[model samples]
Target: MAEEMKRMIALGFEGSANKIGVGVVTLDGTILSNPRHTYITPPGQGFLPRETAQHHLQHVLPLVKEALKTARVTPDDLDCLCYTKGPGMGAPLQVAAIVVRVLSQLWKKPIVAVNHCVAHIEMGRIVTGAIDPVVLYVSGGNTQVIAYSEGKYRIFGETIDIAVGNCLDRFARVLTLSNDPSPGYNIEQVAKKGEKFIDLPYVVKGMDVSFSGILSFIEATAEEKLKNNECTPADLCYSLQETLFAMLVEITERAMAHCDKRDVLIVGGVGCNEQLQEMMRIMCSERGGNLYATDDRYCIDNGAMIAYTGLLAFAHGTTTPLEESIFTQRFRTDEVHAIWREKEATEKKAN
Candidate 1:
């Protein structure tokens, strides 16, 4: 089994968002080489969707080449081409999909387009070995509680508007936090120095959650307080972290209640937030549930997750034909067929 898996080289492309990452991963989750790199739109350059896509188009090939070189692997050595399918900008996804298609033909390998969100969740599962945990995916574009159900992964709960990470990033931008550094990281830094807690709206809907109201409230409060020089940026940052993480923890605990799950796994970029993880740990422990998280290698946006998921899909024979090869802007989590152990079984039978 190990030998067979080694024979497969999964080259993953992640252009679903601002980051354009390419990695080469094997079946056992061993990232043979993932040359880390990122593409950033210039500061004060507000979100230009098409321009972002164009930036991805410009960098995709160079990044992939650098990754393959770093991995010391040739094009013919690769067995599959994988890319982030959706839940991101259409233009950037198209760039990745087109590249994958061209590479599939060049290398005569299978192409797999995977759900970006599901890829993040699967990365957590692979890294943490959380067999049946309820997933809390918090990122710039998404925030949701997901569980595998029926033949598809279902969204137990999610944000009604902007994602938690997006909320944080917007707030950070407003506060002139580090633009070069990741927002979540910078927010975590500022959060530690905060001395006082400020109240923010806590909006929860059954199992679902919303951050827009809370974000607006915080922004307004920050603006009003700034006029009086009432609070330091660090204080506001810490207070914001506490409030937002508490909301996330509340929602996750509620979902666990409905699911009766004993394992909780967090994923995506926001998973790196220490405050969020700490709150989730406390909440899960209070509920007699275990909490797991992926390390930095798997947490932030990367191509490794795409390659890993694509390898699973390919091994399970859930393939796509060229005619049907197109990216969706909003692919749902439930759209994918979960085949973890089943994939191993089929691979065994094939041999």
Candidate 2:
């Protein structure tokens, strides 16, 4: 029977946080279609969780429709549906969860709730083909250093409070920088034009990291310096980038040392930073190790990675029963059982 051709199609929903990204991916790791919908919280919105959820609800359907059209696939063609399980806004996740559940029911297929962080890691692997690399996820709400251990994905280190991207966004907001597209983009532009590095605290707790303190220190310094005419925005931008990227790279290097792994894979929105990528590449090269990253297609929020990971999960026969499945606000990466390899092995044996 040739093991039923080992075929599968997955539709991924990523309404976690602010990005309403959707895509269709195939079992061969090919991204058939991807569409992204981005929303920026107004400055005075105060990080209201409910507001973020509403934002996601408004954009999910349109993004999904575009993705399906781009992939030239219909809902009926999807073998399963996948969504970010947790570590995101309750309402936003619910929006995606509800959509996935309804779609699964309509298509008479299963749903696979995936960990957002794990999806990032798996995407790195798929794009870069880096086996067992130390993975770093730096995004709006997360900063984690992960390595696969035993039967679980182990978090060797992570943010004690705020994530790296959050720090940059908050700082950009304080300066009243543009948020039309993204605050990160403005910060990166400023950092490039800047010539000096304003001093900022580097907080590293063993393997764990804390960016809140650094963010606060930078804000205070900026205010005091502006009053005393001590620093400029360009200089401040340069300094902030240096400090933040250094802290991230340092911990990643330490993780590599601790794990004795040479391969490093970085994912998430912040992973798009060229400076950070350069730093990691230098560190990896210095250690005679390899480093991998994705282009904007996979780095910035997109559904392709989710769809890819979902395809692997579905192919391995790991699925969530529609009735019992629900969106999770605190899904952990290690909770996902690794089934990709096993499923492939079984298929080969059967053949």
Candidate 3:
């Protein structure tokens, strides 16, 4: 393991999606400050990439300034600049990258490019103190069950289609729900009042799950109900949550079994759902295991994760040249070599 350093600091920029977050962190895992602004669109609408990018462009600098002020650190105090380099929307990724480049030039500090998914996993581990848990990553853009082995956070299973969050958000649009706080949050609120659990398609293939079919089925059912005045939106929301969360919990359990890991850590935006967490807790309790998950703050994508994970890389002598600091839209989680975990993995294998 890279020996812990004295007072290493990093500033992170996150704009891979609708939210733009700026954060500062220390090498010892203290989150100095994290601030974010989300770009919420009107009801029955999804945020466009171009508009989201524009929103980031407008607010990133201000958020960064706020983060610095909150963290009590100036640009000169930062050891390095970090930013999400990808597995996200290209335009938003570019906006963050541009900010990082400008900041690096101004501060004359090294740049650390972080993989978005890896950042989530690392942040979850840090906050929850989960050691070698089977990770269930569910978010707006991605879904996968992951575990660490060899030199990478290996993908044990993944979504064959739309992610769970995407499914929920699209369904919210169908219901003309506000996207302000979050479409999923609105669904959750309405789902609380739902008494009926309408049957919906459940699709799980081996270790992987597919939500596109489930989404299509529920959407069509919703439309039919709308035409005939057959069911309330709350009922649909309840049914959707039950069905989808069940699928996630099932796959997560399968992954836990396959890895022989008793600790399960849920990361990503959809991981914040209380229904999903309750189901996971029940499954873990039944198996005599444990579950670890962050609240909305850390579970959702944020600059703190990017900064913290980048500090890990920086501690181990990882740096990105200006020429190589470009963003990517398809950076897979398994593609990242977890150098920070090398010592920990080696020790576990030996023991």
User: Per-candidate RMSD vs. true structure?
Assistant: 2.7, 2.6, 1.6
Q: Each candidate's lDDT (Cα)?
A: 0.82, 0.82, 0.93
Q: lDDT of model 3 at residue 297?
A: 93
Please give, for residues 1-351, the per-residue lDDT of candidate 3 as tens digits: 334474889999888999999999998789999999999999999999899999999999899989999999998899999999998999999999998998799789999999999999999999999988999999999999999998899998999988889999999999999998899989999999998889999998999999999999999999898689788999999999999989888888998898898889999998888989999999999999999999999998899999999989998889999999999999999999899899667777899
Residue pairs with backbone overlap in model 3: none
Model 3 C-alpha RMSD to native: 1.6
Total backbone clashes of model 1?
0
The CA lDDT at 61 in model 1 is: 85
Cα lDDT of model 2 by residue, 1-351, tens digit: 334434578889887777788988877677888888777766523355687778777888888888989999887888888988776888878888898888877788788878888888888888888877899898888899988875567889899998898999889987888775678777888888887667678888999889898888989988898779787787888899999888889899999999999988999988888888899999999999988998778887778777788778777667888776777778777787767745544667799
Alpha carbon deviation, residue 269, candidate 3 (Å)? 0.6
Whichever of 1 and 3 has more lDDT, that candidate is 3
Predicted model with the maximum TM-score: 3
Which is the winner by lDDT between candidate 2 and candidate 3?
3
User: Can you give the lDDT of residue 210 in candidate 2?
Assistant: 90
| Regions of model 1 farther than 4 Å from truth | 41-46, 341-351
Candidate 1 worst ten-residue window by lDDT: 38-47
Total residue pair clashes for candidate 3: 0
- TM-score result, candidate 2: 0.93
